[model samples]
Target: MNHMKRVLFALPLLVMASSAFAAGLAVTNNSGLPIDELFASPAGKGAFGANLMEGIKEGALDDGKTATISELASGTYDLKISAPDEGVLCTIKDVKVDGAALTLTAEQGKACK
Candidate 1:
């Protein structure tokens, strides 16, 4: 039936749309210091939501390594990367993830040792 055909056609579109918006956060450690925590939350919010990667047991991200932050819905986010002793290494604001993942790196001033 024509109705059935339309439904079938729309199904792929839905899937594609969802996948397009599903790109998550990715952090690349360009700094020489190891990154112990990477947290992201909705922009303009008071607190960070959760750590995307680099936990206590798993160890931190070494220099020149990139890690992905899964389990986040696509949206604008504020990112924070911390040092091994909980010092603030870098803070990035207004990161947008629409159809592709957001990649962040610690450069110069933001790269605290």
Candidate 2:
């Protein structure tokens, strides 16, 4: 194939490939029962808002579902999660990754009443 033909053909494929895993953000809460139902939200919701994918796993607490950042691009992204209460303490911190295989944790507990 000629250079131009190859470039043109590969262009769409490249874009699609990137878009496939363009999630850019994710969140997970493995705090274990009881506390696990403390909070929930998408991992990217903290910093990027709607620019990145949002997921939540409140597990039966009506909180939400879990969010995974496994679909992020090859760069540095600040993964974060929302807190369900004040002084309650919920966190998903220091999740820096390159390419993929990134995991962020979210936890919350306080004033469960």
Candidate 3:
């Protein structure tokens, strides 16, 4: 029937919408040092993708600032925060982003500095 066909067509779209809605990552900068770039990629991938959040005119992310990334698929990702000079400030591994949004905070410390 036409009604049955319509329901079948809409099922896939509904599933896609649900999956996309829950795939997001939020990064908060509390490292004291300014955040100049943000990198994310699948766990164990080693290579990081493009900057999810771009700085302002080569500037850095101020303290208490947050960046949201919604384009990534649902999976575990490794996150790295770096300074404007391309120095690694913080590295968080095995960040799971499943059917919900994940929040990551960068704290100030010897490891992060």
Candidate 4:
């Protein structure tokens, strides 16, 4: 009975900890251009992973529009935004993401190319 009680007591904490591990990012395009691609990488990794915008049904994320990237683990990340045929428009670094939806605007980016 004591073991069962202990297990039940820890169950909710386990659930909360698991939920806290999942994170998401909400990006708003404000760079005065349509964003054709967006990528997120663990901070300081140098190489970016997948294009987060690939799943969007409306094509490019137009200026002033927002998109959410889900299923990411909570951590620091770097964001790369690009325009169609324009190469990299900007890269935003050191974005801290927790379980809450973190918001980013294009104006926060640097190193346009």
Candidate 5:
């Protein structure tokens, strides 16, 4: 290959390499309550969104609340709800997000117990 041809070929490859990146998830809460905490990692992401009117704390999560999570990776996650200031409550539920939306509702009695 000529010098000019080589340079042109290499330029495209470099651009492609930089643009390639891993996937990511977006966490949103519209349950009319404040989510305690959200857990996300390179492996995947877990979300806990819910309404606090039903015995749930406003702008906070008490014992149990409404929650919904999505965009979880293809693995296992120890998911729980927290107050973000007072730590966690209820129990740590073992959740699985297989590269799709995993809708979850905060529960008191879980299988982990």
Candidate 6:
């Protein structure tokens, strides 16, 4: 019975700790172009993760608009923004995300080859 109580007490702490490591990112498109796709990966990782724009209802984030990406963990990341027929617009490197939410602007992206 004592062990069961201890386990129950620890369960909520575990849940809170797990949640603290994962967070949502709010990206604002202020680059003067529509963003058709968005991808994020851990910093220094060669490959980008799945397209984050697929979760948006409009299928894209237009200039001056904001969208929330809910699948990120608290850490540094690289962001890739692309447009249909325009290829990759830019890539933003070393973006730090922490806690429950972090906001970023697309205008910070740099030209990529």
What is candidate 1's lDDT per residue for 1-113, written digit by digit as tens?
99999999999999998975654445566766677777777897848866777343447876787665565666887777777564556667777766335455555325444
lDDT of 2 by residue, 1-113 (tens): 69999999999999999886665444343333222222222345554444233233432222334544334555444433333442233444344555534433234222212
- Positional deviation of residue 20's Cα in model 2 after best superposition, in angstroms: 5.7
- TM-score, candidate 1, is 0.55
TM-score of each: 0.55, 0.33, 0.55, 0.61, 0.34, 0.62
Ranking by lDDT: 6, 4, 3, 1, 5, 2
Point to the candidate with the largest TM-score: 6
How well does candidate 2 score on lDDT at residue 73?
A: 50
What ranking emerges by TM-score with the best candidate at the front?
A: 6, 4, 1, 3, 5, 2
Model 5 ranges with Cα > 4 A deviation: 1-23, 26-33, 40-72, 84-88, 106-113
* Candidate 1, superposed: residue stretches over 4 Å from native: 1-25, 54-58, 98-100, 108-113
Write one digit per residue (lDDT tens) for candidate 4, span 13-101: 99998865543456566766678887788999968888877777678877778776555667898877788665656777897877455
Off by over 4 Å in 3: 1-25, 55-59, 85-90, 98-102, 106-110
TM-score of predicted structure 4: 0.61
For candidate 4, the lDDT comes to 0.71
Against the correct fold, how does model 2 do in TM-score?
Answer: 0.33
For candidate 4, the 10 contiguous residues with the lowest summed lDDT are 104-113
Can you write out model 5's per-residue Cα lDDT over 1-113, one digit (the tens) per residue? 69999999899998877644323333333323244655433323445433222332344433434333333556666555444344334334465556544444434223223
lDDT tens per residue, model 3, 1-113: 99999999999999999976754555556666667777778898888988876534435666667656546667887878777554556677887765344454543323565
Candidate 3 vs. true structure, TM-score: 0.55
lDDT of 2 at 21: 60
Cα lDDT computed for each candidate against the true fold: 0.66, 0.41, 0.66, 0.71, 0.43, 0.71
